[model samples]
Target: MKMHLWSEFIAVIKKEVVPALGCTEPISVALAAAIAAQKLSGKVQKIAVCVSPNLMKNGMGVGVPGTGMVGLPIAAAVGAIAGDPTAGLEVLKRITPKDVIQAKALLNCDSVSVNVADVSYTLYAKVTVSSGIDFITVTIADSHTQVLSIEENGVSTYIAPQFCSKKPQSYDPFKDIVVKDLYDFAVNIPISYISFIEQAQTLNEALSIEGLTENYGLQVGMTFQRNIERGLLSHGLLTDVIMHTSAAADARMDGAMKTAMSNSGSGNQGITATVPVVVAAAYLGVGKDKTLRALVFSHLVAIYIKSQQHKLSALCGASTAAMGAAAAITFLLGGNYQQISHSLSSMIADIAGIICDGAKPSCALKVSSAAGAAVKAALLALDGMHASGDDGIVTNDVDQSIQNLCALVNGSMMQTDVQILDIMINK
Candidate 1:
């Protein structure tokens, strides 16, 4: 692979995968609040935030890290009170119990409000924090941490250049690429060039261990372990994959303080993309370089597919992330590029319709299901069983298969997002 192409691939990975402290929607809200609070004088007296409908939907039910709470109000309040603006997505990391108390008090006093913003971007947040008469506003849009503008007392202070970014659509580096480009890059690239990618394993696995050892969320991952000890569930590669993958999701969705190496702005998607590949590499006894290669392949593929969709969609992100896992697992199984493509098609065929109701404890179940399907999809592809064009969405061309999924969600099923959010808010 050429160095320029490698640079592009690395650019996408660097932008997409990073450490996030909580479900990204709430974390982004906290980040906005933190940035806004930083520009204000004295103690924070009030916080008002407007987030996109998609963000509102996801943040409504998910846990906010270390606060033992769910939703964006507390996140914004705590952020304004104690969050670190420099921490970016990990803005809520330094929050103390006292901060939680103060945040909850702000909520009690009705000093914080989170409303669905009528924003042009699908993923957007506008946060305003007031300290008596001193106030500041911060707007984040297009991607988490992409601060669009900052204003103090109605005077503009900063605006992001958004160098490569255009309107209504994100910049697309992979527009001319396909699965083969990712494959060649992962396989042919020097191992030294991509060794830093290993941090994903270190970070996500910590959450997995935390989830399994302690009680968090639904305990979906821990339950599998107990079932195995009871001889109800067999101890094998699949179980190992599920235990690790779902455990991470369990801890993350439940608002564990540990950061997850998120892909495409979602912690669950990160867990889905990372854990299965890690477990499968260990199960196969692959070398460090090989494991890293598979990791890059899986992550980039997930990023590629995920970047095509509305950042927050009713289409479950785990579906695309797991497809990446399926591809990497097949590659580890010593399958050729054709089989890797087949693995993706098979994954799409099996897990295509998994709707994302919202982000919460139950998301662990979804990631686990998608992880299992990934392994199964890889195995079927290794056995030369590809989903042909005759199937519903799975097509002869892998790229078109991906387009089919994107088109379905971004077009006809867009109302699915509206209805889902309406039901969630109403409920």
Candidate 2:
């Protein structure tokens, strides 16, 4: 790869892969509220938060970190009270017990109101904080943490040109990336440039341990381990992958005060992409360099696939991240590019249409299922078995098959997204 291309790839990875606390949907809300709070001079008396439908859907039931509370109201209240906007997606990292109390009190008083906004973007958050007669507004749109506008006292203070024009240029750094390019980059790229990928292993592994040790969310990982101890499941690579990945999700979805190395704005997706590959690398006795390379492959594949869809979608992101894990596992198993492609195809064929209801404790179950399916797909690929082009969305070309999956999620599942949100809201 050319030095320029390598530099671009590294930059994209750095931007996409970073630490996040709690579910990103709620974090985005909190971040916006925090920014609005920063602009206020007096103590905040009220807050009005509006978000896109996708954001509303995902943030509805997920736990807010350090608050022991679920949904957007508490997230907004805590953010307005104690969140640090400078921390970006990790905005709630500074939330303390006192902050949680204040947030809960604010909720009890009905000082914070959350509603779905009429917005075209998949990711959007607008938070307005009031202190007596003065108010400040902060808006984040397009991507999580991308603040598009800020206003104070009903006056525009700052507005992104793209926000005004409403014709934001699509800047996809991975636009030219294909499966072959990802493989070549993973194997041939200099170690020094991509070595930082190891942080994904470090951060996500800690969350996995935390989940197993404590009863967080569904305790999916702990349950799996207990099942293995009871001789119901084998103690092996597949079990390890499922347990670690699910455990990480369990902690993340349940609002454990730990940072997850998020990919494409999702901690669960990051866990699904990293834990399986890390477990496989350890099981295969791979060294740091090879493990780092495989981790990069897995993350890059997930980022590339997700770049084609909305940031938040009706389709379960774990399935896409699991496809990345399957590719990495295939690479670790000494399978070539063809086999890696086959693994991705197998994954898409099996779990391409799992609808995302919301981000909550049950997400751990979906994460575990995706991880197990990833291992199965990798094994099938290693044995020279794969889903044919005739299978549902699988295509002869791996890249084309990925595009087909994206089309289904982004286009065909549009109504599915709305209906799922309706069901959740009405229920």
Candidate 3:
């Protein structure tokens, strides 16, 4: 890739690798609400939220980190009470116990209601706030940070969402990236950017430790660790890497308080892509540049998968990200471009159909399983193995393989996604 192209890739990576407080779905709700709150004058009294089914699905079940509460109502309340819209996904970063108390009070007064939109989009949020005689409304559409409208007192300040974003650009990951590029980057990027991976190591690994301490979630990763101690599996770099990485995921999905390094908005997805590659780097003793390159490859592959998942789906984002981790780990382990492609193909072939019912503590088991599969896929690829392209949704080309996986997520699985949410809410 040209230097300029590399720079552009780096820019996109920086944009997507942002810090988020709590689960991003609710935090995004708070972000929308905060924008309306900021526009309000005098004392704000009432707040109403309108969200699409997809947003409501994610916001419904996940625990908002720091607060024990579940769902969008409290998120909106926190937004109205203490959120800073300008802070974006980190809007709730400053939330305190007092703020939580006030937010719960707002919830008690029946201040929030989430209704499905008449028109469906992958992402949407509408927030209305009333302050005595003053009222403000804000709508977030399509993309985060791209608020479509803001109105107060029957007057509007027109700001186009396009103004905040550069002209629309399409990304072709394979055009600029091949297995060689991924491998070289993993072997040669700077330390500073890759150092962020440490946060994944510190926070997620700690959560894994906590998970083991308390026997949280399905105990998949922790259970694997115990089996290793029993000599069921040898103590090797691959085993250690996969175990530490997925164990943290086990803890996080099971409601550990630790925050994950969120990528494209999902915490478990972030952990899935990050921790595995970092653990590989640690065990392999790769230099900082190599580590950074691996981190970039891991993170970007996750982002690309997320673009297809589009923030909502029956297909879990962590599964997609774990596939990316499989690719990155393959490259880091001296696999060629063919091997990397094979690992990705094997992953999609194996785990492409897992459903994300909702954000719940039980997600840890699913995530650990995915991570374990990813490691296995990478190992198989290293041994000159590849999933047959003729097999179940597998494709010969890497990009086509990604497309096939995404189609299962986006096109053929909408009903499965909606039905799961219905079951959760009705039950």
Candidate 4:
């Protein structure tokens, strides 16, 4: 890779991978509400929030950190009362017990309302907060925390035209990123430049440990550990990988107050991409440099694949992130580029169409399942076996195979997203 392209890749990683305090959908909503509240005077008497359908679908069931509450109403109320907009996705990190009480009170007073917006963008949120007759409106679009506009008292205070409009043309920041390029960069990049990726391991591992040690979500990771201890499940690399990764998801989805190093605006995706690779590298006793390289490779692969799909989609993100883990595990196991590619193809072939109902405790089940599939896929790839091009959505070219999977999620699954949302709202 050229120096310029390498620099761009580093920049992309820094921009896309960062710490987030909760599921991003609700955090983004909270961020918008926080921004709107910042523009208001006196106590916020009412908060009305409208989000894109995808946001509504995702935020509807996920827990908000520190509140032990699920869905957007509480998230928006808490944002108005205590969120720090400048924190971006970590906007709710500062939320306190007092703030939780106030937020709940606001909800009980029926001062907070959430509705689906009539918007074209897959990622959009509009938050309006009122105090007496005065009101402020803040909108976020295109990307989480990318505030599009802010209006105060019927007067526009700030607006970015490029992001404010709904007909914005598609933008692909990772257009230059390819699977081969990712492999080469991960292997060849200077250790100093990529060492920052280790923070993902530290943060996500902490969440995993919390999940395993405490009862959170469905306790999938804890259950795995218990089963292993009781001799019901084998103790090995595969179980270790699933336990660590699913535990992280368990804590994240069940509202642990800790932050996760998110990838592509998702904590679960970050955990899925990082923990499996970390466990595999440790199990193999790889050196620090090699472990870092494998992690960088895994995370970059996930970011690259997710770039091909919408930020929020009907497809479960764990499936795509798990493919990245499979590639990393293959690399750690001494598999070459061809084997890594086969691992990715095998993963995509296995879990191409898993529906994303919502972000909730049950997400740990999918995360564990995807991690297990990734390990299976990697082992198969090492043995020179994988899904053939004739398999559904699997192409001879790994890149084309990824594109085919993305096409299914982004284009063909439109109705699936709508129907899922309908069922969720009605339920």
Top-TM-score candidate index = 2
What digit string (tens of lDDT, one per residue) describes model 3 on residues 209-299? 7766666556767777789889898777667766776677666654455666777777778778877887787788877566667777888
Model 4: lowest-lDDT 10 consecutive positions: 167-176
Q: What are the models' TM-scores?
A: 0.96, 0.97, 0.87, 0.96
| Total clashing pairs for each candidate | 0, 0, 4, 0
Model 1 residue runs over 4 Å out of place are 1-3, 163-171
Candidates sorted by lDDT, best first: 2, 4, 1, 3
Give the residue spans of candidate 4 off by over 4 A. Answer: 1-3, 164-173
Q: Model 3 segments beyond 4 Å from truth?
A: 1-4, 163-243, 250-258
Candidate 2 at residue 220, lDDT?
97
266-376 per-residue lDDT for model 2 (tens digits): 999999999999999999999999999999999999988988887788889998899999999999999999999999999999999888999999999999999999999
Better of 3 and 4 by lDDT: 4
Off by over 4 Å in 2: 1-4, 164-171
Tens digit per residue, CA lDDT, model 4, 1-427: 6555777778788888899999999999999999989889889999999998889888988889999999999999999999998898899988899999999999999999999988988899999999988999999988888888899998998998674578566555567556988888889999999999999999999999999999898999999999989999987999999998999999999899999998888999999999999999999999999999998888889999998887789999988889989999999999999999999999998998889998889999999999999999999999999998999889999999998999888887988998998898899
For candidate 1, the TM-score is: 0.96
Q: Which residue pairs in candidate 4 collide? A: none
lDDT of 1 by residue, 276-307 (tens): 99999999999999999999999999999987
Instruction: Please report, as a residue range, the 10-residue window in candidate 1 with the lowest summed lDDT.
Output: 162-171
Q: After superposition, how far is residue 416 of candidate 3 from its true place, in Å?
A: 2.7
Indicate the TM-score of model 2: 0.97
